[model samples]
Target: MAISSEPRLGASTNGDLVNRVQQLRLDGQLGAGKNSRGGGGALLPWVLCGLLAVTWAGVGVRSYKNAGQKADDTASAPQGTAPAASSTNTPQPAGPSAVAEGELVTQLKGNVIPSLQITVSPRDVAAEITEIFFAEGKRVKRGDKIATLLDHLYVNRLNTEVASVAAAEAQVTRAQASQTSVAAKVAKAKSALAAAEARGTRATAMQERAGKDFDQARQQRASGSIALLDYQRFDADKQAADADKIAATADIEAAKREVEAAEAEVKTAVASTKAATADLGAAKARCAEAQRLVENCVVTAPIDGTILTKSADKGALVSPNSFNVAAGICLIADLSKLEVEIDVPERQITRLKSGQSCKLQADADPTREYRGVVDRVMPIADDTKNVVKVRIRAYLKKGEQQGEFLKPKMSITATVYNTPFTFDPSKDLPWGDEATRK
Candidate 1:
């Protein structure tokens, strides 16, 4: 029989086999004679075919092993995480019973935020930060000191005002003393005037008695019953009484003038006292204002919360004009009150409603899922992005710390169900599934 050279297995396989056989014949491995029809020479094609089969078998085995290794690698490697991952080893929890078939479920990206965040800044006063009592992430209560500003200027102002108040009070006291002295003088003058009037009355009475005696003497002298010397003596007595009465009248006028002057002095003193009191009042007002400014220099927390960030450090200059982060001392927030802020497209805004249930997964910790509800859907929309902002009130599941995983400003993925779910802020059951409590 003649050996056919037809390529059966493949072009390359047949060519390789043929080339190997030719080379073997040239090398005298099969037989030395070309026309030699020995058993070895006749078995060459069968041996080559057997060798080819064996090579193909090894190749097939290697390929199978490689394919199996790839499959195993694919099966063992980690896969991409879903939007909301399961908190436990089990799969993600199912949506609430409120969700119906083919309901519009909207997926959104948002950031975690505190419901009440306060930016602490100095008001009205411009001063350099001297000390910081609290650091970032520190918890504090209302009225707790957070920072202190340099108060030397304010202290100096307060001291000046205090001194002014003291001076004003002293002035008021002096005026009061002067007023008392003048009032006493007025009383003394009044007493003197009364005494003068009494003296005048006595003088008039004596003058009248003297006149009666003189007249009686004149009548006696005319009737030849009195002597000339006695009459002259009576007239002298009347003249002396008249002079005494005139002097008494002059004394009374002097007393009246003195009383009037004293009263005027008293009025002047009262006016001075009133002015001094006004000055004291104004000084006190200034002092109180200065004290308030001094107290303001020490910044304190307005509410019970944790410090989010420290915008200004010690020795930094700050003022009310430098608002926001530029002059702010720190950011304080109530970590217990948390929310998620998302922007939904205008077309999808209709699908979102208040009180709708939502599932949240923070990018930082994708393994845990949080529960929340749509608290508000902003009525306004952004013209540039054509999206409306939405806020979802959220809370940590049971056994989780307030700010451990869901922190302010943390990026997260949120899934909102169109159906509304009953939510109670006091309970922790709705935050996690009953089967897999997180």
Candidate 2:
């Protein structure tokens, strides 16, 4: 209702305002309508109250229409859009954000994964699984025998190598003996040379003596004091002595040649000895290598752990590097160590960091909560899922670290609260120091 500031007494209007108010007041429509000259005090209050009442009624009608219109609009609009704001006295609550209820916490879902799972394989050697030493699920110390491959084959190879080494050793002995024999021959040749030289010296002396005798015979014969035959005999004797000296010198040279030949034979024998020694060493090395391979046939536990599975039994053929649940020699794990591995979505990965504490609940026992820490935060991400793999080391309560409460490959939920903290590595110690599994 539009109220006019001035009195509308014009004939063009629906009716005179005073007359209208007078009729409504008589009918009790207005609270009081007595007219007064003093600024129309009685009429003013009544008129104002009537206008206010009309205005509120119109507002109520419009509100009802608007509500219907909103309902229709909402029904016709797309699935998820919110309705327009409504006029209310109180304010609306805010949605979840960084400062959630004045605290910062990040929760993630992950599964329980193995921390010290070991699957023994026959890595480079293809051999038949000949025997299993320990029972499955039994605890074993490091270096303890778990199984044995076909060692008979390797043992045969080792024996053959040993025989070869022995043969090479014999060859080396024969070469040494040959060297000794050549050395003796060289000594004999030297002795013969010395004798030849002595003989040449004696021949030289006899020649000189014969030459003097021949000269004396020639002088006597020429002075007719000796016979010609005697002089001729002395000349013949001198010539024979000269010939013996030449022969002796020749024998000395021949002996020297023989000695040189013997020395050459000695050198060849020494070389042969060295070659045999090298061959023996090589054969022995081959034997040692074969022995090592044979040793590998006996498989041993690499860590103090429990055997989770036995994939291969006696007479089963196992290829090196064969692994998995279907076929393998055995699968072992250190039950003392456990971890929860979860894939944190790329968006939430930023809230997690190494050393952050986490609360864990297994799918098997959701009520029982376990404690753990963020052991690692991978720098890389999985492109397909857009997530990062995080490993959480489980912290067993009291002496439960060595207990069998948790098993590997158990599905579990991990709740991690993002906060700054320190992680102690010593808390995870006392691990199996058993020999590293082969």
Model 1: lowest-lDDT 10 consecutive positions: 76-85
lDDT (10s digit) by residue, model 1, range 264-383: 999999999999999999999999999999999989999999999988898889887754436688899988778899988665576677777888899987888877878898879999
Model 1 scores what on Cα lDDT? 0.82
- Per-model C-alpha lDDT, please? 0.82, 0.75
TM-score of 2: 0.64
Model 2, global lDDT? 0.75
Q: Which pairs clash inside model 1?
A: none
lDDT of 2 at 12: 53
Give me the displacement of residue 310 in model 1, in angstroms: 2.2
lDDT of 2 by residue, 1-438 (tens): 978788646565434644565555432432244332243444654876589679989999999999897786565322233544656886755532242331234555666666778887654455888778877778889998877787778889999999999899999999999999999999999999999989988988998998899889888988999887887899899999889989988988998999999999999999999999999999999999898888888788888888888878888887765553224578888877778888876655666667666777887788877767677987789999877999988766555545366777778777666553333345444334313311
- How displaced is residue 410 in candidate 2, in Å? 1.8
- Backbone clashes in each candidate structure, one number apiece? 0, 3
